[model samples]
Structures are given as C-alpha cells and as structure tokens.
Target: MLEYAPAPESRSVVQIAPSYGLFIDGDFTPGKDVFKTINPASEEVLSEVALGSPEDVDRAVAAARRAFETWSARPGSERAKYLFRIARIIQERSRELAVLESLDNGKPIKESRDVDLPLVAAHFFYYAGWADKLPYAGFGPSPRPLGVAGQVIPWNFPLLMLAWKIAPALAAGNTVVLKPAETTPLSALFFADICRQAELPPGVVNIVTGAGDTGRYLVEHPDVDKVAFTGSTEVGRQIARSVAGTGKRLTLELGGKAANIVFDDAPIDQAVEGIVNGIFFNQGHVCCAGSRLLVQESIAEQLLASLKRRMSTLRVGDPLDKNTDVGAINSAAQLARITELSEIGTEEGAERWSPECSLPDRGFWFAPTIFTGVTQAHRIAREEIFGPVLSVLTFRTPDEAIEKANNTPYGLSAGIWSEKGSRILAVADKLRAGVVWANTFNKFDPTSPFGGYKESGYGREGGRHGLEAYLA
Candidate 1:
C-alpha cells in the first residue's frame, strides 16, 4: 500500500463546501433527498450533495425553458463572446480544476491536468468558434435552438463529460438542465461556480445532481425538448424505451468493448504502449476503452510477454501522486462489477494474470489484469467490465481480425496497428466502429465527431455533429 500526504497547493484550490445543494436558476438550493459523495481512493466521505426529485427536475426545466426564450434569441456573436469568456476562465483556473478533479474522482493528477482539464477547455474553445457559424453548418436558411435540453453524464470523465454536454448545447443556443452522476457531482458543482464567473445568464445552465431517479425525471420532464445520456448499454436501452412515444429528441453514448488489433509487422514497443493505454487509462473507466486485444497469431506469445512486462512497471497508488499510472477504481459498485466479471473469466477457463499488487485497505482498488485463451463467447470478452481488465485473443489473418473485432454487439471504437499504411486503412475501413485509430487508442479531440454504432448507442458528442442533438 502507498502512503498519502495532503498537498498544500492542491488544498488551496477550492474550499470544500459544507453542504452542496442543487444549482437551479443560478443559485444553490436544498433538495428533499440527499446523497454522499466519497473519495474513491480512500473511500472517505468527501461531502453530501443534494439529490433532486421529479419536482426539482420540473423546477430546473422551468428555469431553463424560461431562460431559453431570451438566451437563444440573443445575437450569435454575443453568445460566442460568453463562450469565449468561459473558455478564458477555465484556462485561468485549469490547475485548480485539475486538483479538485483528482481529489474527488480518483484519477491521477497527471491525467486530470494533462487530459481532462485541457480537453474541457479545448471543447469550450472549439465550440465557441461555432456559435456564430451555425448558418454555414447546413442546418437550414436559419437554424434554431431546441428550447431546453436535459443531459446526463457518466462518472468516468466528470468535468470533461460535462464540457461535452454543455458546450455544444450552449453553442447551439439551447439552455440546459444537466445531471452529474451521483458519485462524482463535486466537479460539476464547482463548474457551476465557473459559469457564475463567466457571468453566464441566469438559468442558462442548471445542474441537478443525483442518481437514476433524478436522471429519469430530467429525461421524462415534458418541459425538456431533448435528452442526452452517456452510460451503460442496459440503461441506454431503458432510456430509449421510456422515451419511445414522447417524441423527445434523444442521443445516447453507451458502453463499448473495443478491440485493439496488433499486427506482426508493428513496432512492438509502441504497440505495447498503445495496448496499455487502451485498457489502463483512467483505470479503464472509459466508455470506449479497448478492453479486447486481438493479436496476430504469429506474434501472440511475444505480445503477451511484452504486455505483462509493461504492466509490471505501472504504479498503482494514490491518484494525487504524479508517478501513478493506474489509480483506484471509481467506486465500490464499479469494483464489484470488475470482480464479478473477472471471476466469470476464470470460470469460463480463460487464464487470468494479475500482478502481485498490494492495495490500500480503505479504497476500491484493482490491479491491471489480463486474460489469455479468451473466446468470443466468454463473458469477459462480450461484457463491459469497465475496469483495467483486458482479454487476449488471436487471429490468423486480417479478415479474421476484422471479424473478431466486430463480433461484439458494441461498435463504439477500435484500434489497428501495422507498419503498412495501406493495410491499416483497409482494416480501418472494414471495422464497424464509430472511431477507428490506425496506430493509437483512446485519442480524443473536441473538433472530431465521436459516438458509436449499434448497441453502443447513437448521436455524436463533438464536432459539428454535436450541434444536431440540440438544434431544431
């Protein structure tokens, strides 16, 4: 187990609020039901956050609906200016935001700083440029905003996900009522303060934090014109079912079991690095994590050996530590899901290998794990474990690789590795996934369109396609 010491620099970022409440109509107000947020690294109580009910959702929707009439009618250039101000404020407070994200979310400070916070700002900056350019986006002679959008995001990338949800809605001139996941609501609460700093119009963006009930309320509220969600495939189906006859515009970015294909001709060291990053980044809590590895049969043994050696060097400890590569699991419920799926892997006769890692007594932790001899039917191969668990399978040829990659019901993302550029392009074209990386995995850009096909859910969250979900 690794020891932890508080950093004075990080502690100074934001004072922990005594009691967090719903951010409705540009103010914090109490809710009838409340839930506690915990630090996943140590399983310590961080704070209690208000859990809004259907009535609270109604109030937020009303606030957003009321604001939309005026906010959406404002000049496009003026809207762009507000987005620019927000982008500037986020840049100024990037360090503070990164530290708070690490403290509350159990992702390494390095990732929070280098990945999440920067992407959040980039997303805002990217969308700001589109505020006045919607006429050129092929919307119509004159595009218009959806009155009020209801958004629900997952816990994996809290603030970044918030940016994905809010920036495009605001850029499209839609007011928003967003719900941050119950366990990771602190950063969203802090972000509400950022909106105030930017002087964003009252009720332009309201955050109501809670669990499934809160999300259901927000999605089902008649006042909401659109619904956006990012989470599990099962829940995505449920949301689809619930909104079936309502005619509400809906978009879902759900679960994935992406394949990382390694060809024999690839650079072994770089491919190994990409493979590690594919499954281990953010402790593999990503929606499009490359959890399934399909190695060319000729190099399967060599790749497995190299991957295990690389896994041995990863530092798993306090997320605040700069040296840590893999941090604690997001929450107890997630840890249980990882554990259950891993057991299923063993029972189905796959070989499971985990480093001899000692974990902290209090936090939810799981070591980097790999399963060999995994077949397509294995639960580990088919299910979304949502943890640092990788399953290894082998393919004899490029066609077999493409077949194995697309075998899963998920079509979110996939990766291809090869020295030949033509081969990479050929395989990339054949795979049935939304995002395909020729030589990388888990790479993201705010200007790029991202979403999934089939059961992985629909609707793009970034680029010009993002505005489609929020526009009339």
Candidate 2:
C-alpha cells in the first residue's frame, strides 16, 4: 500500500459563524436555549446552534401552516422555478456545502463531495422537473398538496435527508417544518440560506433545530398534515405511535441489519471490494449498510482472507483528507454503543479482527472491525450496530443463505455477489430486503426509490413514489 501525503481541504469557502439560530418565517430567530455543534473528526467546536423548545416547534409549524395556503395555491410551473433556483444554488456552492458536511457529519470529504452533494443536487433537480408534471405523474387529473409537512431527519446524511424531505414537499406545493438531528445541524442551517437566496415564500420551508423533544412536538402538533421521519426503528415506532390517531400522513425510513452474501462463484477480488464498501463507507453510519456477511462455506476461507487483506489498506483519519477512506464515528454516544456491542460479541465467543491503523488522538473514533464465528442467535448478528462493524457467518447452500438473510426483522437492503446470473436472480428473489444489489453495493440514485420492508419501516424516498408521501 502507498502512503499519501496529507491533503486537507481548505475550509475557507465555508464560513461557520460563532452561532446559528432557528430558521423560521424566512429568517433566523433566537431560541430559548442553545447547544454547541462540533466537528466529530477533530472534536472542534464549529458553531453554537439553537435548541428549539416546544414553543419554537409550535412557531415553525405555524409558519408552515401559514405558508401552505399561498404556496400550495401557486401554479406548479411557478413552484418549479423556485426548486430550479434552489438546485442551481446547490450546484454553484457544491464545494462549500460538501466541505461543511464533512466537517459537521464526520464523513470523508470524497464521499461528501463526490457522492452526497451531487445526490443532494440531483434530488432537488429531479423533483424540480416533477413540480409541473404532477398531472402526468399518474396521480389523477388534479393532485393536491398536503398542508404542512413536519419532517425529522437523522444526522447520518443531514443535507441529503433534508433534501429528501423538503424537495418533494415543496415540489408538491406543501410547506415544510423540518427538524435536523441535534448532532449535525449545520448543513440544514446552510440550506436555510439557500432558500433565502431563491427568495422562497416566507414559511415555505422552516427549519427547527433541536433534539428528540423538538421532533416529538413537531410530530404531535395537530396542525401538521404530514409527518416524515428517518432515523432509528425505535424512534420510528415512537413517531408512528404519536401520529397514529392524529390522521396525519406518515412516512418512515428506518434501521436495517442488511446481509451481504458471497457465493462460491463470485469474483473473489471484486466481492472483497464490495464487502469493504458495503460495511465501511460513511464509517458504516448508513442505515442500509451491509452489516452481515453470509459467505458460502465452500469459499469462506478464501473470501475472509481477501476481505481482511482489503480491510488492511483502508485509510482511517481526518474526514477532510481526500485520501481517508473511513472517518471518525459520528458521536461519543454512538461510539460507546458500538464498543459495547462489539465487546458483547467477543464475550459471546465470536472472534473479532481489525486492520492495524493509526487513529487520531482527538474526536470519536472506532476501528473498522469484523467478527467471525457469529451465529444467528448472537446479538451482533441480530441487531443493527450502525457502525464500522461486520459479522461473518457461513452458509452451506443458497437455501441456507436465504434463510439466514431473511431471518432478521430488518429488510432494508441485501447484496448478492455471484458470477452465476441464475443463482443471483434466484437468491435475490427470495430475499425480503427492499433493495438488493446483484454485484454492486451502496449505489444510490435520485430516480430510484429507496426504502425498506418489515421492521425496517415503511414508505419510500426518491423516485416517483417519494412524491406520494406529500400529496393528497
């Protein structure tokens, strides 16, 4: 492996102020309390952000309800123009947003720049085209926008999740009250600036920043016509219960313990790469991350050897370094959870292994690790670790692999790597996951719908199906 020189991205383009306020009614307002936002990579304080109280949530929801009457009545063509302007601004400031996202979210600059920011822009652009074409979108002659959409997004992909929630809501002519996750709220705050640049209608998009209490208040608010949430399945269930009798529309993108199966006929080299990308990308913070590896017993040894060799070369360090493959863990609490789970896996008789890599002294960090000899009953295999951890298990045949893969309650995603097309198709058909990648993993597109089945939660984001969540 070659050692690359440190190449840190300049942060000059992003001007993080000393503090930020709640974005409501087309402006920033002081909140009752405030919390600090930090860079997970360096543990550096980035900005002080407002912590929205219940009253603040009420204020944001009121703003959205007020904006909806006029915004929803606007011609779809006019709504399209605003979305186009937002998209253009995102593209123009892509570098700045990308850098800011990496700093706030602890994801590699390469992914924040190349993957996330592009998708963020594409989602808006894709939905922008749909704004004026709803009549042709198979939703009947005159589809109507839901009134006020109250959305809560996770920190894993803050800006992108914001786009997923806000774009369709706006394109469908509904106003929005979005609450970004507390740990990473800067990107969404910056997005508030973009809305201002587009001269969007006051209260058309209101961002209330805070923790669980804030999101709970928004979801339980009587005036919010629709609720969209993306986070833990536990929290998803809470949101579901909270909005049950309210008659508000709900869409949830939740947790997963996806299985990545490797057959004997798979291209071992490429399969190894896919496995690495599956579990380690974004420090394995992805909800759809492939965390379980069910390898065919016939080639299990060879695959593990190659997989470990590949893991050895992964670069883990500063998120801003272009060459860094794995970044810091998102927060201290998440790191503790990951550590506790991995320790339990070891105590339960599973074997753990990690590549020899130097970690930064500051910030929350966890080494990319894999466990062998894991069984279906093991907690590590059954639960969603949501970190850079993989559990390896062996399967005797395709039937056995399918049985183990479907055993979990999560059905978010799965991966099948095989040279035999028939076997790949046959196995994929049996997997209960919502998204199954035949040879590749972690690939996403705005035009493709993404979601999960079973306990992983319901409804879809992206593609034409995403629009249904905000429409009447």
Candidate 3:
C-alpha cells in the first residue's frame, strides 16, 4: 500500500469575520448575547456569533410575518427565478462553502465537497423547478404557501439540512426564520449572504444563531404558522409538546436506529461496502445511520472479519485533508455521548472492537467502532447511537431477522442485502422503517422523500410530500 503525503485544502477561500450578527429582515442586527463557534477538527475559534435572545426571536418572526404577505403573493415564476439564482450562486461558491462546512462541522473534506455541497445545490435546483408547477402536484387546485415557517436544523449536515428546510419553504412561497444549531452556525450565516447575493426579498429568509432556548422561543412564537425541525428524538418530542395545542403546522426529521440486514446468500463484497458506508459515512453523525447490523447466522463470522478488515483501512484525521475518510466528532458533548454509550455497551455484555488508529491531540474524535455479541436488550442495539458505532446481531431465519429489526421504537430507515430478489422484497416489505434500501445503502436523492415513523418522528422532507409541509 502507498502512503500519500498531506494535501490540505486552502482555508483562504473563505473569509471569516471576527464576529457575526443575526440576519433579520435583509440586514445584520446585533444581539444581546454572543458565543464563539469553533473548528471541530482543530478546536480553534472560527468566529464569534450572536445568540438570538427571546426578543431577537420575536423580531425575526415579526419580520417573516410582515414579508410573508408580499412574498407569498409574488408569482410562482418570480419565486422560481429567485430560487434558481440562489442555486446558481451555490454552485459557483460550492467549493468555498464545502470547505467552510468541513471546518465548522468536522466532516471529511471529500464528503463535504463531493456529497454535501452537491446535494445542497441539487436540492435547491429540484425545488426551484417545482415552484411554478405546484398546481399539478396533487395537493389540490391551488396549493398555497403557509405564512411564516420557523425551521431549526442540527449541527450534523448543517448546510444540507438548511437547504432542505429553506428551499422547500421558499419554493412554496413561504417566508422563513431559520435557526442553525449553535455548534455549526457559520454555513447558515454564509447562506444568509447567498440570499443577499440573489437579492431575495427581505425577511423571505432570516437566520438567527443560538442554542436550544432560541429554538424553543422560535417554536413557541405565536406569529409562526409552521415549524420544521431536524435533530434528536428527545428534542423532537419537546418541540411536539410545545406545538401541541398551537395551530402551527409541524414537520420533524428526527433520530433513528436503522438496521442493516445481511443475508447468507448476499454478495459479500457489496454487502460489506454497503455496511461500511451505512454506518461510517459522515462519522456516523447521520440521523438515519445504520447503527444495527442484523446478519444471518451462517455468514456472521465471515462478514465480521470482512467488516473489521475494511474498517482498518479507513483514514481518520484532519477534516480538510482531501484523502481523509472519517473526521472529528462534531462537538465535545457529542463525543462524550458516544463514549458513554460504548461504555454501556461493554457493561451490558456486548463485545466492542476498533481498528488501531492514532487520533489527533486536539479536538473531538471517535474511531470507527463495532460491537458484537449484541442482543436486542443491549443499550447500543436499542438506542440511537448517533456516532461511528455499529452493533452486530445475528438471526437464523428471515422471520427472526424481521422481528429483531422491527423490535426498536425507531422506524427511520433499514437496509436489506440479499442476492435473491424474493427474499429482499419479502424482508423489505416487513420492515417498519420509512426508507428501505435493498442491496444498496446510504443512498439519497432530492426526488425521494425522507422521513421516519413512530418514535423517530413524523412528516416527510423531500419530493412532493416535502412541498406539503410549507403549503396551505
């Protein structure tokens, strides 16, 4: 094997200001309190960001509400043009934004550049085409935009999530007040700039940076007509409770403990690749990560061997390095949670394994880890371990595999790997998850609707269904 030297992407492409203010009504406004956002890979403070106080939330919502009357009244063709302009600007600045996302969110530069940014641009492009065509979207004759939408996104896949929330809302002619997670707020601020460059209407899109309190305030704000959130199931529950009696329409893309099933007759190589991509992509920060591996008893030994061998070759280091595979954990708190859950897995009698890899001295990092001898009762198997951790369990029959896979409260996503079409169809039909992948895993498209059922939360976030979230 050849060891390649470091080829780090230049950080000079992005110009980070010393501090940032909240984006409200097409302008940057100062906030009462401010916090520093850091580079998760190096633990260096990238910039100080304003924390939106309750008053700040009120102001932003007021701005959105005021603009919604005029913005929503605009012809769908005009809305489409604005969205297309934003999409073009995103494509032009994709590299710079991808680099900024890698720095802020600790995802490998390769993924940020290849997967995240392209998807972000594609989402806007897809939704942009839908703006003028909503009448035929099967949502009734004249599907109308909901007034002001308050969207809250997580730190993982920060910019992509922002695109998911903002694009659909704007395309549907609704104005937005979005809150990016505190840990990775830079890209959203950058997105505010993109809106400016496109000359988007004032208050059509506003970004307020802050912690959970700000999100709570935005969700509770009486003026918001719709609320969209993507994060932990626990936090999703809180948001659900808060919006319970309010007439605000709600959509949540929350947590998952997805199962990746491997059958005895499956193609071993492809299945192994699918399994690795399922759990290890984005350092397993995915909400729909395939954290549980349900393999047939006959192939358990061979599959585990292949999985471990493949994991050993993964490069875990600087996020900005073009060759890096896995990168740092998004934050110290998330790293602690992953560590504690892995500890509980050991205490609960599950076997743990990781490749021998040296971690950097600074920043948050968790190696690719997998647990064997895991049972349905184990914490690691049941809980949403939103990190680079996988729990391996074996089943004897297709029925048993289905039973074990559906045993959890989560129903976000699942994967089935089998060469036999009949068995793949049968197993997929029985899985409770909203999204199922057969022979392939971790695949996403803007046209395909993505969401979950049961404790994983409700409502879809793509395709025609996504338009329903922001539409009247």
Taken over the whole model, the C-alpha lDDT of each candidate is 0.91, 0.94, 0.94
Q: Cα miss at 155, model 1 (Å)?
A: 0.4
Kindly give the stretch of ten consecutive residues in candidate 3 with the minimal lDDT sum: 1-10
Model 1 stretches with alpha carbons more than 4 Å out: 1-9
Flag clash pairs in model 3.
none
Backbone clashes for every candidate come to: 0, 0, 0
Q: What is the lDDT of residue 338 in candidate 2?
A: 99
Query: Which segments of candidate 2 are over 4 A away from where they belong?
Result: none
Instruction: Summing lDDT over every window of 10 consecutive residues in candidate 2, give the lowest-scoring window.
Output: 133-142
Tens-digit per-residue lDDT, 312-385, candidate 1:
88888888878888888988999999999999999999999987777778899999999999999999999999
> What would the per-residue lDDT of candidate 3 be over residues 93-137, giving only the tens digit for each residue?
999999999999999999999999999999999999999999988
In candidate 3, which residue ranges exceed 4 Å CA deviation?
Answer: none
lDDT of 1 at 446: 93
